[model samples]
Target: MDLLEAIRKRRSVREYTGEPVDDAVLRELIEAAVQAPSAINQQPWTFVVIKDADRLAQISRKAKSHLLKASLSEPAHSFREMLNDPDFDIFYHAPALVVIAAADPTDWAVEDCALAAENLMLAAYAMDLGTCWIGFAQNWLATPEGKAELGIPATYAPIAPIVVGHPRRPPPPVPRKNPDILWIDAQTHCA
Candidate 1:
């Protein structure tokens, strides 16, 4: 699929069929992810793939509890209700999760990982797979226990927690509003 087409069609899929994504396919997605341009060619991203069902549920519960307790003091009021429900999985029951992490001191680490994540997500969409960046897992994943659970080093920061699997159904397209633009050509420049 064309890049623009994939960009337009790709959606943050929440529901999955519980089918495990193949290791080869996951490797292909990672290959695509690493192809993303990095500042100064640091290429500092690492991945942690989680396919264990029981572990996924366990982490889901822990992360949800952390978010609920956190929402009390923070401004995340909108997520409290959904986080309170035990059945509402943050992963949407996907069979695979690929986390993108970068070394703590790596310059432009967050931006680099985000670029890689976009590549992975677009590649998944083109390959008839689904992907979603699980923001709810970020904070917990940074904790020491969470890091140990995934075997990510304490010196690395988990920037993207993406779930991957066969989509249960194609998500409906969401409309986009016109972008606000500013023209600063010579003709439009202020005197």
Candidate 2:
């Protein structure tokens, strides 16, 4: 797929076919992720691929519980309702999850990992695979128990918990808002 097409077509896929993502394909996606530029070329990112069904279900349950107990903010409230529901899987039942972590908790760690995540997502889209960043899992995955379960080092912080799988169907194109560009020429800047 063309880069532009992939960028435009990359939707946050919530529903997956539960088909197992091949190990080779997952490795290719990781390779694409690491190719993303980082601050000062630090490349301070590590990945934990979770494929075990039991582990995934356990993480989903724990993360949902954590979200339910969090403060009742706008988004949290919405997620709380989802947690209340018995059928909703926080990971949307995707077969594979690629947890991106920052090896060093620098100021730019989150930003650096986010860039890599975008690369991974786009790469998956190009390969006809589906991916969704499970932001709801972020806080839980950073906790001591979460880290221990995944064998993540104490210094490394989980930056993104992205689920990867085959889409049950192609997601429709979501409408895009107009770009809010504030272009300023040299003369305009000087003025």
Candidate 3:
């Protein structure tokens, strides 16, 4: 698919078919991810692919538990109920999880990883695959126990915990908001 088309149509998929995603396809998505631009060419991203159904479910459970105990007073109330639910799979039963990480906690690492993640997500959508970046897993995945369980390195930071799988159905397009522009020309006076 064309890059712009992918950009416009790509959605954060929640429902997924239970079929396993091919390794080659995952590799292709990672290759596409690495092609993304990085700050000062740090190219600091690392990946951990978890295709084990048991493990993804385990992580999902742990993540939900962790989020439930966290402070969910007001804004976090949005997730309070779902996290409390016994059957809400954080990964939505996706067959693959491609975790994007940063080797070092540098200033630009998160930004760089975010760009790579966007690339990976777009590539998945273009290939008729669905992907969702699970933010609920981020905090737990950063903990020592979470790292040990996933075999993630001690110093590495889990930037994006994305689940990849076949979509149960095509997600309807969500409308985008118009950009709030502040165009400043040479003739415009400084504030």
The models' CA-based lDDT, in order, is: 0.92, 0.91, 0.93
| Model 2 per-residue lDDT tens digits across residues 1-191 | 89999999899999899689999999999999999999998998999999998899899998888878877688567666678787778889899999999998787989999999999999999999999999889988999988998998877899989999999998899999999998887667552
**lDDT score, residue 139, model 3?**
90
RMSD to truth, every model: 1.4, 1.2, 1.0
Clashes of 1: 0
Local accuracy of candidate 3 as per-residue lDDT tens digits, 1-191: 79899899999899998899999999999999999999999899999999999999899999888888887669878888888888999999999999999987888999999999999999999999999999999999999998898797899999999999999998899999999999998889986
TM-score, one value per model = 0.95, 0.96, 0.97
Judging by TM-score against the true structure, name the best candidate. Answer: 3
Candidate 1, residue 93: lDDT: 96
Clashes of each: 0, 0, 0
Per-residue error for 81 in candidate 3, Å, reads 1.4
How far in Å is the alpha carbon of 33 misplaced in model 2? 0.2
Off by over 4 Å in 2: 189-191
Q: How do all the candidates rank in terms of lDDT, highest first?
A: 3, 1, 2
